[model samples]
Target: MRACFSLDTKTEAIPLVPLTPDTLASWLEAHPPRVRAWVEANGFKGKPNSLCTLPDEHGRIQGVLVGLDTEAPVWSVAGAARKLCPGTYRLDTDQDVAWLTQACIGWGLGAYRFDRYKSAEKPAPVLQLPEAVDADEVLQVVDATALVRDLVNTPAQDMMPEHLAEAARMLADAHGAVFSTVEGEALLSENFPCIHAVGRASSHAPRKVELNWGEDHHPRITLVGKGVCFDSGGLDIKPSNGMRQMKKDMGGAAHVLGLAKMIMAARLPVRLRVLIGAVENAISGDAFRPGDVLTSRKGLSIEIENTDAEGRLVLCDLLTEACEGEHKPDLLVDYATLTGAARVAVGTEIAATFTEDAPLYGELEEAATRLGDPVWRLPLHKPYRSSLESSVADIANCSSAPYGGAISAALFLQEFVDPQVPWVHFDVMAFNNRGRPGRPKGGEAMGLRAMFEVIRARFGG
Candidate 1:
């Protein structure tokens, strides 16, 4: 992935121009008037997502003009970037590069195509590096995002429970973090009963990936991700349409791991603990029934209201285990593609995040705002707690209420965390329904950067 930043203002050496339909006539009418001749010769229409090369009298390449429909749409400059000729260019006028800076970062991201299974005949187009952009930092962020997208985009056949654990192991090895995993029957012995029950039905088996780093004396930050590798919705089967993209259910793990990579790369000063409960909600004779009562790591029994709601089940145990661990962290955060209710509430682009800590929430919001990777905070209303009450078990995995489904899901996870601990839960819709700049219409890394920025600011880099 490669990128270049541009300014529209005129300069002696740098020659780049913004191509908009409204500006086309004025740009042609003014300065060096031959600019009009080039438009006439090429029949350049200046349509959105269009591109044209500018040349001198001898037909030597001078600069380039790109048509952007919406300036700074979360992932800007992503549409026509891949189609441009490979070279360095500058903008013809002055516009804020803050959005362009982030947009160009996304072009590097959209350029990513998973060619692991098969190779591409032509390599992705790489833009000449720009002076204003930190090429290395842009590549690092874009590459990390691609890493998460690639991990989630891979099919379950290649990305199973063991494979997810292997991904963690590789990350741990790269960063030199202490890595450990509780697998198969060991999950029961380790008191991860929900994880055991959900995974026991699969031949691939269920496991938890644990990676820890930083000094014990530093502030502790724990991340718990729900890694339901392939969700068939278990006995509570999903329709064909609903299950089509189930491979991305483990997107939470990808996000946490991606964020962890950024933290480790930047060498932030805080103890980081990552927990992933990797499982497959496959159908078999041994699958847990909807009416079954399962004990969790926290000793609370929960009744299954919907097997489709397994993300919360896996997270409940891991959250308790994380909070109860030695040297409890001041902050604990979990990310998951837990509910469709979230997508309904906030849509796909903005992930729904909630936190008990005001300062933490404010910092996260500011970080997202600064980085242009925004996440909207949803409240964890206490009145909704009654919706999760269970007659058979201590609680139910899902709520009976039709309203506030996203809120109820957050409340369910909140039950596992210690009351005094400041925590955040992100209910993210990790896939993009429509293609846009920087973000292609496929598996994407939503809240990874914003969360990383917040942690970096709250602690240190």
Candidate 2:
């Protein structure tokens, strides 16, 4: 059980009462004089995320009044968990089951602390498990999310390509998934030339991890993630400021791993295959340079306009293998911290997605909306394909254009994808620059929940 939750239903705890702006006055009237006086003294308003504690004559906490917006999100009460003193809290409210479930999940999310590097001064507040929601099911999502956060939060020294492969192996072992990998020179032998080219510069050898689960007769679903362990922009190096948070370059891999966990845990009826190409875009004497043409696994000649744009290279190979050579899935989705331009367009908070298949994109949007996990779809504008064209190679990794970089980057990957396959590509930030209710300022998982819902909707769980 997660430390954030008190699963024991009979545990003694404080009552956490929720109040809306209109009901605050009525609720105060219903309470005794001491409770009303405390409320008046504190000038408590039923504003979102605001809280006021009512005390008895003995100066002990009688109950807690937490303000909530009428149409609050899943994370409405998340901040309360972080702010509350260490103790167990039981919500006393009449909200529906959905609200109850979200509140529980939100508490778990907010209570998370990355204590691997440094211990916390105190343990987080705990919320008693409500009888209304499915505890095991909700905890599965929380555990999967924690997996993503832990992997992404680790520094490059501990989270290199080889380390990531081991992590995948561990996950595979637990879930009965068959895991295998090809690293260093083995990547070349396995025909993953682009993955090798990007990761070879690092002392830590680059690797590709593949985990296969589910029976052969089920509908096939393939997931690919770009696991650039730490990107230094190679020979076309980025400025120091740009390179500061490059440890999160593998956020895409974290997301796919998390999404895969959710799918497998639910026993979704699909032949699931997870592919991650882990690499480091480091500067070295042997590093692949600007204008260098490299042959992709699909035999497409790729011209490197800038080594900074290497996530696509790591992904192109895996994407090709997933959609073309084998495991031609009913759905092929790839996630990557591929483009900064996506952040420029959609801001860091919202995930920007690109897909040529309109119907597939619709399903994704529907799932995101239904689950309150957000995603904004960007067009794979065909005209932008001209921006990636190279006279030397079949296509350049990226053009020097100052516009529509996110769209163009998606177009570059689209070239390798078989048009017959329904494909969705996510260009994500995967890190929060600022803290919010449940989202801390570190490595984060962006769209996995929505992706899981989409998978479940298409293929029965």
Candidate 3:
């Protein structure tokens, strides 16, 4: 919860000039001879995301030049944060509110490092809060993002169902929200049989963690997250490579927690309900197996075609529970690291989004485009619903066919949701496979900002 930026207490400006390839030569001519010589000597040709530091006459830090693309994205300024020496820095040029806000966010993201278990850690260079940016808004985004990263980065041994529940409890306690859980046999008694079945094998008990906040008069929004703490693919079993980073399987739960923190911290005018189905899919004699039929909370029977498809099983029960209240939520959003097919279709950078409601999808799309958080829409094809047909149960956990796996997964989940409620499901990667200027190579928060923007736009922020 540390602040990424502070007020510029000093009067001196450590000029940060963003230059593009086309304008590099002309801009270089305006600088002093020594600065120009340094730029040439170092071969600083203003390539996008490249940085060069200039020195004063006494060999002290003077200013910095950052390379940018012609149509530079807001995060282009992140290069300065990554490359700069440990000291206070400021933007030399005046920018609009949106640009400044994004630049600040990018700077914070670039400066982030997961050193929780490290023996030593290095401090990052600080950027002064620009006058154009809203400090609270930027900090909220940064803190929420950091929370997601921290939770996902943790090893499975440390981030079990109980640990995730405790995290939810802490967040709820911090915001004065009501927090509760249904654990072990309590889940079965509560009619969350599918959730209980998937998690019953692991030593760490499976549970549903719920957090409710905001006034009764406010608009209702419910968030459901699939919390597979560690997926060893259950009895079906995943390949060794597939199970390597299975610790991040709980990323969906982490994401919802992060988003919940943001909404509560911003004090958005909406009644928020967060439900996380926390469990670990492990090997044991009691592990749920393929061909097993489990009755869901919604009273729908699902035949397990593959135990590896456990995320949907957990989410279906949670979704059913979320929609059953006296007054249904105005909007129901769920996040899950549901399918490898989503990754195959869109890769890791874009979240594969599926929603039946057009208006809600439009809002999400617009928010993502505006915030530079990418989400690609994949169909919940009605025809694919037939692919999930089972001999005994109402539906199969996975499709009989291999193609359009992501679409089929969405269709399977759509069965649990009410047709009337506006719902959006994000199949997120929740990790940056390759590090970029601002995004590091580790557990990441995908679609979080865009989703938050949609909620803010719908309800008062």
For candidate 2, the TM-score is: 0.97
lDDT per residue as tens, model 1, 13-75: 424465678877777787575777777788776666666677877887777666654544334
Q: Which TM-score value belongs to model 1?
A: 0.89
Cα error, residue 408 of model 3, in Å, equals 0.7
> Mind giving the per-residue lDDT tens digits that candidate 3 earns over 179-249?
99999999988899988999999999999999999999899999999999999999889999999988899
Over the full model, what C-alpha lDDT does candidate 2 score relative to the true structure? 0.88
**Model 1 clashing residue pairs (backbone):** 7-91, 8-92, 8-93, 9-93, 9-94, 16-90, 16-91, 16-92, 75-437
Check candidate 3 and list the clashing pairs: none
Enumerate clash totals for all models, in the order shown. 9, 0, 0
Clashing pairs in 2: none
Error of 2 at 161 (Å): 0.4
Give each model a TM-score. 0.89, 0.97, 0.97
Q: For candidate 2, lDDT tens digit of each residue in 1-461?
A: 89888778898888888887899989978878877787888988888878897777788776788887455456767778889888889989988888888777777777777779895569778898898888987797788888988988999999999899998998898899999998899999989999999999999999999999999999999999999999999999999999999999999999999988888888899999999999999988989999899999999999999999999999999988998765589999899999999999999987899887777778888877765578999998889889888999999999799999999999999888888888889999998899987778887888877888788888974
